[model samples]
Target: MAVTANKIELMQIADAVAREKSIDRMIVIEAMEDALSRAARSRYGAETNVRAEIDPQTGETRLWRLMEVVETVENDSAEIALVDAQRQNPEAELGDFLSDPLPPVDFGRVAALAAKQTITQKVRDAERENQYEEFKDRQGEIISGLIKRIEYGHVIVDLGRAEAVIRRDQQIPREPLRQGDRVRAYVADVRREPRGPQIFLSRTHPQFVARLFEQEVPEVYDGVIEIKAVARDPGSRAKIGVYSNDSSIDPVGACVGMRGSRVQAVVSEIAGERIDIVPWSEDTATFIVNALAPAEVAKVVLDEEMERVEVVVAEDQLSLAIGRRGQNVRLASQLSGYEIDLMTEEEEAKKRQKEYAERSALFMEVLDVDEMIANLLVAEGFARVEEIAYVDLDEIAMIEGFDDETAQELQARAQEWLENERQALDAKRREMGVEDDLLTIEGLDLKMVVALAEEGVKTVEDLAGCVTDDLTGWTERVEGEKKHYEGMLEKYRVRPETAEAMIAEARARVGWDVEEEPAEA
Candidate 1:
């Protein structure tokens, strides 16, 4: 073995190549040895059976032939006699490992080519390993990186050696990102695809806010305070329910920090998304009330059977507790694990009255189908619709007009009405605003406009001003021309000149314009 100047320079080149390509130097050394060995074999002919070794420290090169011990060898160039193998090492047996000296010839061109190819393969493999290690443990953590560019809606985030992705659904609404601007997000998910390792990041996830709290508040990390539930309308508002093991420590106060420092940090990170940290209570009533905090709850009536809670707030607090389009109460319902029904006292009282009216209407709808049954109900002094709806059919038959067959029919019809009434009452309990009130209208009545307004549909501005989906869906529930309902919405969008004509026509309708009075002599 001899150390050549070329070998010394090749070692230096391997070091430089490893650093440039982010490959390991050991791979370059192994590949160089293989190339030199292959060159020796080609020079001496394929029968030479050559192998190569490099000095670990000095990078000296030597080539030799590896021949196995044989009983009788047909090819003497590649096989060693058993006697020779035993002489080299006494433990060597027939077909044992043995090496013979091979004549070294410089096959400069072939060796250089083989060296280049080996280096390339080794470098690629090493780079792949480096990439796997770099990104393996980064799952579920938040990363802040530069937005390199966007292809489709997926943003490439430059994270030093590699880039991660921020998918379209992961992005917050109305939040714009630009190249070079730093964006931070939670690592929502990851997968390996044909392109490479795919990483998904998010700013809208509820966990993103929860993680921010953990980072900002020491109480959360120490497990003294726990985030029980989180509901987010990302980029707008977030509600987090927090509970504390320590009785004296206020969970809400801990999250809020001194002068709102902790929460403000999270809000700032979310690009001014508001965070409301409410104290978590095991009691469903208390939890619901707290969930809708900042908007006082007058009462919370829990329905254990249906997993629902009717939340009654003050008249003025109604809008605040319900938020814009019931976003507040919706989040509260999610946080408290109950189907929430939000209303002001005025709204609830009106609902009770409406329910009483529906029950009465149900009684008449069924009994009026048969004259004999109607007479029996009337004779029972079930004069009010609710009274007939509530009274027993057996009691009706005992009086007069009802026989066994008639009584059975009346009873069956009354039960069906009662079930329908129950479903209507339940629907009213879950939703608020115009939809809740509009249910009272059986068929489209000209009086619908007035009745709706009286319940909660205050103004045209109110009627057409809600979310387009909620408004359109409400209008379709009317059992009339679909175009007429759509046209009402189209009317709302009309220009002022056209609106004037429509308003004049609407004003003439009895209840359309409350500002104008009835004509009197």
Candidate 2:
């Protein structure tokens, strides 16, 4: 090749650099133009207004001094009078740039070094931008690379186009990753920093296991089976919940493959991590039972209000259901979206007995009934005296050993007890200085009014300031004892809808300010 200082040679250099750096050709050309402009400024006095351009097709370099065509030339290097500019171009107007070509200079060592530095910096910036654009969209995807090196416990992988890093916390615990090892990880995040694009990879992410299955199982990749949820104790064990839209396909069996081949592939990739493939169910109880695999469950009791589930297993299966260090139940909880509490069948029986005794005790004390009668009421599923007072007389008479006369007597006693309780609460409400307006609120019964008065919420204004959680009993610690406020709604056992209506009515009445009484004069 002949060495020539020509436009063709300049463009060839640009094309080569662009291909090497994987950057746009025009970007490389623009960098070259900037370098040339700097060199031209050095030669034509530092104060000269210089600009440079390159032909996109021909790669020709043009260096010129730019001066504004102004009426008065204050800065000789930057501005030229209209008369002088008109000599070159008759249509020269004020504020127009008049470009004058300058002769090219021979390359000096110092100038060449400066241009090299400028070009290198520009190329580096463009390379970073290219890397960010390439990897930003790759998040949540599985990426494979060679482990380039380990810097302070972080594994830097050579991803061919750009390098990615897996921090110490992101790697599977105790996973032995050596330099030059082939590693597969999930692209967790991509951040553009001042230095370069930061690509974060993770081997411990739940999605990493999901992606591995996607690669190993054709059913998952083709959307025949959907991976509903995944929970991993990275490098130890993991659970995957899968579902299938096609009735012919078994989601769990498809994920497990024939004789566990599919799951085995994913396990091998994760360094011998065990995987439990479970079929997903729309029913929460069924899903939780499926999540706690390898153990037979006797029963599952769901507390929908608390979003918790109690799983009772045989005594012998208790340890297995809970897993080593509670790992099994924890992962099951995460996968099923419910807090799981594991217990043996014996323990559950004891708990039921304790709850039964407590409910019977509550009824006996509140309704002033004998223990035998309280037990009968508890056995009939009457947990509260309010149910007894409001229930149909025929329903109570239907109970064994209870005739119509007895039912009437029980109903009269219950009603009398409630009335007496209300009268006492009303007296307390008056003594607490509760405003009459609060008592008039439709949902504010005598019991709720008394409870609110005790809490220092005696006025409509005070009631309106309370939040829903405060209005409905909230848990707190008092004097080292865990106590619940048992707010107006909870103490009276009012329905939530009724409580909301009462609060709304109170807020509407709270708009009027309570006027202060004048002192005796």
Candidate 3:
């Protein structure tokens, strides 16, 4: 008994394989052609230029040996003279490929094996290419699949047409997945590799929760409500910030649904992760307060220079505001994109008192005045001695305890104290090996020059290397104490703007090219 080769059966097999593999019909037909061509070449001479084609409509398979029509024949197997080519086709021209039919091949044991391998390889390659094209554009999308198997704690999911993997770390914490269970995850990434396409799925990503809400909430799906931001703690807790373009539509309420139906759906999908739905505000302060929801905020002081916010809560609300191990503040910081420092109302009051005492003490020591006089100066909003010396007499006289004569006397004392300090600083500057170039810098007085020399920064280059904090004495540390050098600029009545300008001038003079080192993390 011998196996009969049927062209119709070959076409039927190609169609079935094409449908099963989810690849193009043309790809399957091409694979069949490659296989038949390889089989024909084995039966005929290996050097023969064999080619195969199949009729997509009729399933008719044809085999041909191709020869080039050349002016003169070189190799008898590949090329034919123009006269011989024209005999077969009268319109034959030079360089034209002419085909002559070859006898259909009868499969031998080795030839059949070779043909099967060729078809399998071609079909596998086509399947891989199709899979890559199908899933590459689906990145960042929510997809559903069945868990095919688990390999070393990694879940391999069978998406209808392809397969995806969810690594152990990508799965939500403590969420157990069983084989053959239905799973939904976000398509984190798709990569094409030598073997095939690799699809990476995740359930722990912040966007995964966002996508789930989009699926469950109609307002989000229609773009009436937008997910502003999301911060997730995996299977523990999460916070979502949402906004609505239409005033009539409440984004948070829509996401929550009637009696929490929509949010419940999302929570169920993510293995019951507790979620906080916060209304997004255009104002950063309000948004931060919302992000720290269920925890009352008494006050918020923003430091735009540092991109940080000091949030003050009631003494009883401190634990709630900070959450367990500071999780509440940490998530709020992530959602709001600002660092937050949590403090109780009592703590803030104490801090204010400390600041007030520091300011009053500075005035007392600098002006050689009594504590009462320093307290009166600070109470009158005189932050620095320069303000008292240079301000209009009328403004100084407006203080409750000061008449015009008293204001004048205070100004005189301030000026005299500054002059004496400058003379002493100048003597110290000369005693130390301070360079004259440091004194030439604009806005840098003798006192600042002496301070720099004392800190071993005698040259303009050394001063340029010092950061603003060091130059201003803010970085100075006392032995066995947490007190910093209450900044030279602050102590000497130099304006912060003036100190910055002086540092810039020194840097320009020295032409120091190195960037200042960043503060330690």
Candidate 3 per-residue lDDT, tens place, 1-521, comes to 22236766777898899999888889988988888888888777787789999888777777999999999887888789999989989999999999999877777998889888988899999999999998999998999999999999999999988899999999998898999999999999999998899999999999999999989998899999999999988998899999999999988889989999999999999899999999999999999999998999999998665567999999889899888877888889989888798999889999878877998998888777789878887877777778988999998788787799888888898898878877888788888989888888887778777766766888887767666666555533478554767564555556555666776777777775444543433
| Each prediction's number of clashing residue pairs | 0, 0, 1
Which clashing pairs does model 3 show?
472-488
* lDDT ranking of the models: 2, 3, 1
Ranking of predictions according to TM-score: 2, 3, 1
Maximum-TM-score candidate: 2
Error of 3 at 419 (Å): 25
Candidate 1 Cα outliers beyond 4 Å, as residue runs? 17-52, 62-118, 190-196, 221-224, 282-285, 294-322, 333-521
For candidate 3, what is the TM-score? 0.63
Clashing pairs in model 1, backbone N/Cα/C closer than 3 A: none
- On lDDT, the stronger of 1 and 2 is 2
RMSD of each candidate relative to the true structure: 17.7, 10.2, 10.9
